[model samples]
Target: MLETILKSAFEWRNQLGLLNESEALRIFYGPGESNHPELQHLSADLYKDHLWLTAWKKISSKVLDEACEIMTRILPFKIEAIVLMDRSVVASEAEVVTLRGTSRSGRFAVKEFGVKYLVQMEKTKHPGLFLDHSPLRFWLQQTQKNKTVLNLFSYTGSLSVAAAHGGARKVTTLDLSKHTIEWAKENWANSGFSPEAGDFIYGDTFEWLPKFKKRGEQFDTILCDPPSFSRSKNGVF
Candidate 1:
């Protein structure tokens, strides 16, 4: 069952050249594998030099071993590592576990539509870049020209970077985490954007939305991608 499932996954991967090479890809999504019910708990993403697994539910070590062995044997290119993210636990306690090999210095520099983002594998809740949003980023890069953009709950400013790269007149990034604001600045700088290229807001989304509304601040585009709870200083949103 494992071998068949993985083989089909590779076949799907081989056919994904239809997507632009510059965009990052979620090569194998497990829940989308509806035929094999148990395999739905797992998904795989291919990065520049590694394969990343995300598990929503726990499985036996034997099943995990089989999956890793098959991936290592079947993949054509040499991989730096095969990492697993066990998301069965709450985000606060989630772990990025390396099941096969080690990532170089725990950082893998990846690109989407020619935009650079440094992804971390070990000891990080998320690797900074979210591969699933690849197409949306590409859309922003193509469509945001000469527009003013606002990114709410922006993490690491991947979207803002895309919008700015598309020649948006101004890109404003708002986030609750100061770390993410700094991280976004680093990414923007890495992509050849000046520090003054964007306005970074470090505050709660609930508080800021009303303020923006009251102030009559208008933007050509406003993006909001919040976490599950959306709990903030004001309350749940």
Candidate 2:
């Protein structure tokens, strides 16, 4: 048994007890963990009954099957399904497959601190919510009270929704993807906000930033977190 499996199983077994059925959590981190070079290719996340396995490097089918089998036997959750996502290739070409059970709709609701967000398991490479930013989102929810907030590069508007949920007078979310903008709207609605609760801008942020500056627009808080390997209009694009 690799240390990764033992550590992951232990963590999942214990952590799920602390959270309700509505939450999402990172079971273990391995890819960049200097302590675990033996299986740096893998990491896992828990969303309700499902488990998402992200492979930062390609693993042989035999090894992957073995890993999945071990995972099913040890995890205490209901085991709705186990999803493997390969992050070793181009984002467009990355592979996502189910090794056990089924995701049913490939989408489910995941919560953080009782706040709801939609998880699209197979839509894109991302599993709806970014588990790494759970604290940041919670911070936005705690601090933005009766103020205006701007979330730039807001994929799915998770931060914006958090700000609104915390009583922000207004929240504006800007992103390049209309698809994700709509998805963001769904997330906002999932968090118990009305569809008309906030502003969702679907356009190039570069163009919109200049326009906002020209208008002398201001926000009490601004959140900017961009994806690492994004495609700008041309390259990013």
Q: How accurate is candidate 1 locally (lDDT)?
A: 0.80
Per-residue lDDT for 55-136 in model 2, tens only? 8777778766776676666666577888889888887788678888887565577778768888876646777788888888
Q: Write the per-residue lDDT of candidate 1 for residues 61-174, one digit (tens) a residue.
A: 888898888877776667768888888888778878888887755555677767777676677777788887787888998999999999998998989998999999989999
List per-candidate RMSD values in Å: 2.1, 2.6
Q: Which stretches of candidate 1 lie over 4 Å from their true place?
A: 18-23, 235-237
RMSD of 2: 2.6
CA lDDT, every model vs. true structure: 0.80, 0.77
Q: Which stretches of candidate 2 lie above 4 Å from their native place?
A: 3-5, 12-22, 32-38, 234-237
